[model samples]
Target: MASASSSIIPPPQPPRSSSYSYHVFLSFRGPDTGNRFTNHLYSALDRKGIRTYKDDKKLRIGDVISDELEKAIEESMFAIIVFSPDFATSSWCLDEVCKIIECKNKLGLQMVEVFYGVEPCDVRHQIGTFREAFQKHERKGFHESEKIQRWRDALKQVTAHSGWTSKNHPNL
Candidate 1:
């Protein structure tokens, strides 16, 4: 019998200089609150002299995970998730959330979640419509998948985080 060998690999280092005060990564669902809240949030952040990264304007089908989007997420100092009523409906949004959580853990990046029209408890407990949508996704063929687990983990992490809600503003 042959013995298995393992090798160690060093983790990638984050950028040294923090040039921008806040490098913002905006994540939102398109049909839900993408046009309304996301646009306003992006504009406000830009006006406040904060660097922000957002998706393209044109709505092209199957245009998923471009290099620009990946670079933006990687360079961002913080990620902001605008959680609307239909946020959990899109798999793309869920995937983005997973990536944001990954960055948070690996690079010490910060995160802010805004529950626009939904209650925090709904997200925290994965109850109500969220549970239904998630269940549907699983039934549609996502169950027992690593990506689904990651998405679930990301949602839990975001809900557990201390952030601002549309109804209640935190003291900045």
Candidate 2:
């Protein structure tokens, strides 16, 4: 029998770079928290002279994270994923999250998560809106089951890390 590795295709790698261009990569649901939380966070990071990559204005509307975005994520020193109520609904966001997790594992990239108006447990366990979002993905049946599972794994893995949540902090 043929070896399983022989038929399996490897994931694409980002272009080799000696140095990164940005200090941080911000991952968030644009319409959900773009105008308020993410905008403020980006401004704050920028004011501190922390170079950050934000995709809201950079990428044209596309089905998946473009190569430029993949490179941006790879080039950043750290990643901040803002898990809003609607985050999981977007496939691109899920793909980005999966890429972030891959970087964390393969490249030692650091990551921080912000639960914006959502509970950490919800994200960790795929409950509430997270569950609803996945249900939608399943119902649509457009993505391969394997791909959807990867998104779930990424969500669970990221939530396991220590991060911020807006549950008790109304001021934030």
Task: Estimate candidate 1's alpha-carbon lDDT, on a 0 to 1 scale.
Answer: 0.70
How do the residues 3-38 of candidate 2 rate in per-residue lDDT, one tens digit apiece? 221122123245345578877888999999999888
Give, for candidate 2, the lowest lDDT window spanning 10 residues.
1-10
What are the runs in model 2 whose C-alpha is more than 4 Å off? 1-18, 60-65
Q: Which residue pairs clash within candidate 1?
A: none
What does candidate 2 score on TM? Answer: 0.85
In model 1, where do residues sit more than 4 Å from their true spots? 1-22, 57-67, 169-172
- Cα-based lDDT at residue 34, candidate 2: 94
CA error at residue 141 for candidate 2, angstroms:
2.0
Q: What is the lDDT of residue 41 in candidate 2?
A: 81
